[model samples]
Target: MSIMASRPVPRDDASWRRRRLGLFSVCLAALLLPICFSGGAVATPAIGAALHGSALEMRWITSAFMLAFGGCLMAAGACADAFGRKRIFLLGVGCLLLTSLALAFSRSALAVDWLRALQGVSAAATLAGGGASLAQDFDGHARARAYGLLGTTFGVGLAFGPLLAGLLIVRFGWQGVFAATAVVAALALVIGTRGMRESRDPAATGLDWPGTLSFTGALASFTYGVIQAPALGATAPEVIGALAFAVVLAVAFVAIERRVAHPMLDLTLFRYVRFIGVQLLPVATSCCYIVLLVLLPLRFIGVHGDSEVTAGLRMTALSLPMLVVPFVATQLARRIPSGVLCSTGLVLAAAGLAWLARTVGAPDTGVLCPALWPMLLIGAGSAMPWGLMDGLSVSVVPTDRAGMAMGIFNTTRVASEGVMLALVGAVLIALIGAQLPDMPGAVAPDVAREAVNRLVAGDMHGAMARAPAWGEAALRSAYEHAFATLLDRLAIVTLLCAIVVFACLSGKTRSGATDTADLGEPSTDTATP
Candidate 1:
């Protein structure tokens, strides 16, 4: 069992060097993935225009990546644990390098869509392996510091992605963004391959393919159904069929996991109330805040007539605070109870959203000055629980099961984001329809949906041209009214969720297979398991 016998590497200087190298490699992956995601958001319009992609195809460009990434995350986590985390991490970096290069040259929308999906799959592996590696390599206070940096990296990538992409797109077009990403991935691959030592669960055997397949099917079908529902009615055959299939697959996945000897996920993690609460923080944040990365750019470009670069710069208000707050949270953890900090942060975020909602409906609301204060509040508030949640997710599980635990935690974060996007889109489209009940002509619902879609995609001119019967002034008024209404409802729901998160973490922090002593003191539990 000696380190020398198993891997046969020098232990004196090489050990610390390996750890440092591994940490950087993982943080680099964290940094790059968000850029891939949010950069694509900034580049989507140009990509669609150049490829002559239809509205549906454009939607798929983002949806497909999210669907694949979320669906494959847990499976990738399990694979990393069974195989070597280093091997899996290297594989992911290699896949990303190749796919990003391919994406840069892709001329067709369909090709771009598929390439993005490949990138998503690789990203899933990279995140899972990288997180698991960090969890295994560092423990106690060191683990806290490492995760804090990881969270900061996540914020930097997410916050600056659009600004960087705006510059890239302006200078060299959308392809330049992907080309630059490829260079980063290539460097990670080389460092990770040479520096990362192999680590895995020695007791692990073969993968539980049934659980993986069922879970993948469930996520894919559900995502497709929800995304399509915004365009096709919820009752449409494709939507209904996909939803039904997703439900069946979900049930099957649960059943299979329960019976499997080595399940991809440990369902028992849900038994810990505090663990469940920690996981939900990501879901709540993604629904209430992270999704704004996509929505705000569209609002600025589509409704406000701002250029892409201008929109990206304006968003610095929201993202800049996110970049700094996680490091601050690391310091605050020594004094404040994590539970209290998380709840307070969520409530603050809700208040900010509420303020933004009220202001968005104003007659003369402009983009920057009016939005800056609220966006800052939202970002600062959400950053409180950001990295602490990651630390808690791993700390609450058995050491041997860190990979599965991280998989479940991150899967919850990402899948919820995708689901929220679809649900919000559906709500927005339905609200638009309700706001404009009758138009001048007897336009089909499909036709009306298409027009609204164009408006949402930042094509006010196209939307007006398509709906000539409806006066431009009236159409703009209706769309803005419906958008404001959507924000109002979202604010209410986010506030309620904040209360739920507070309640979940208010009681005693139950002990699990692993100790959470580092997280701080807690009250006695009042609620029964």
Candidate 2:
């Protein structure tokens, strides 16, 4: 090898300071984004009851936020590349701050939902721009370390969100969650505005308005259709119409993207099987694991009768490993292939979920500690590939398109998790309702619906009070049974996804493969860099 090839690239002190600022700012935003939503899961019961909301309305509180965030991500990414990353990022932080403050004072469920959706859009801007900032400023080992730290920060938010929210909710109610989010975002905005420099794609022209609209329309329509299916029935005209409209918009989006000079998403990237495999990791986990993070806390409070704080603490078994594994995986990637590591981690997750299913089916045990062992395994396995996969997914992409690529990547991930939460809620309610037919007042549809909603919303005491004639033991058994069945299905599906990921990322390819040595060419995203 030539000496020129072996020597490190030179960077001035000012350049180092600028990149460091960008890294710090983006990672802070990443850390706070998950906390903005995940922490609220522990406070759901309080939010629902305080607003006098039903089960479906409560689902919207979370799903609506995710939907808006996912739907706007690509457009936000394009805007970041065309305009400026620092500018867009600061704007997003401002939006986050304002919406969070409004949510803190929101009196109605509908108002909260709207605020949450706005928050999602702001989050989309921050995440898209933040990712682009890191990709634009760093390359080689520095890039790997920045991505690893970002992943770790993201993991910390997911892990600690509920725990922190639990304490806040106990101290100051559900509104405290939103209030806390605002304060953190306010701090980020101040730091980012002072330290961050502007970065954008010099070659980028005007935004792809047509493509952006079509894609957003498709996603929103499809999500609405699925989310409303349980209440309106799958065949209802509204549901059917929305779903059909989504299909049309999706087709239009593809056509527009293919023809446009500056497309929002570059479809050509999908040709790489490794790219496809890395993207699937989020989807697979969403279907098999992320749903549990939302639902399990409800189970603890509703079924097992644990306090909000206790329930959140109990979840440590599921979240703590993520804090450690992703950071460690950055080092481990040096010795192991990313594909093998990802597949192995997912396999372990599947096994842990299977154990959880069996434990839930025991019918006699009410304690949660028995299941902690499997939860630990599930968390560890899920964390192992996150940093590695995230780095690999963008590293292989042309540096110029990294912003759009990361946006698309995270859009699918967040959107899938949102969709899964809705679907799983629907399924759980259906399973619980199936058991309702044998209970007292089965002939009264309104009574049955109320009972089911209350149970699902983590208001077990209220559910029992509302249905005194219905035996407590029977209600408990039915919910436990439904939860167990859900876990069983998740375990099987996750295992299958792991196998598919392993196959796609297994073999070497001419372009690149999923290993430590394949960081690819230096980014050409910024003309001056």
Candidate maximizing lDDT: 2
Q: Write the per-residue lDDT of candidate 2 for residues 367-395, one digit (tens) a residue.
A: 35778888888888888766566666675
* Candidate 2 ranges with C-alpha deviation above 4 Å: 1-22, 361-368, 395-404, 439-441, 465-471, 509-529
After TM-score superposition, what is the CA distance of residue 22 in candidate 2 from its true location, in Å? 4.3
- Candidates' TM-scores? 0.90, 0.88
**Shift in Å, residue 32, candidate 2:** 1.2
lDDT of 2 at 348: 91
- lDDT (C-alpha) at residue 135 in model 2: 73
- For candidate 2, report its TM-score: 0.88
Tell how far residue 210 is off in model 2, in angstroms.
Answer: 2.2
The residue pairs that clash in candidate 2, if any, are none
TM-score of 1: 0.90
RMSD of each: 5.0, 6.6
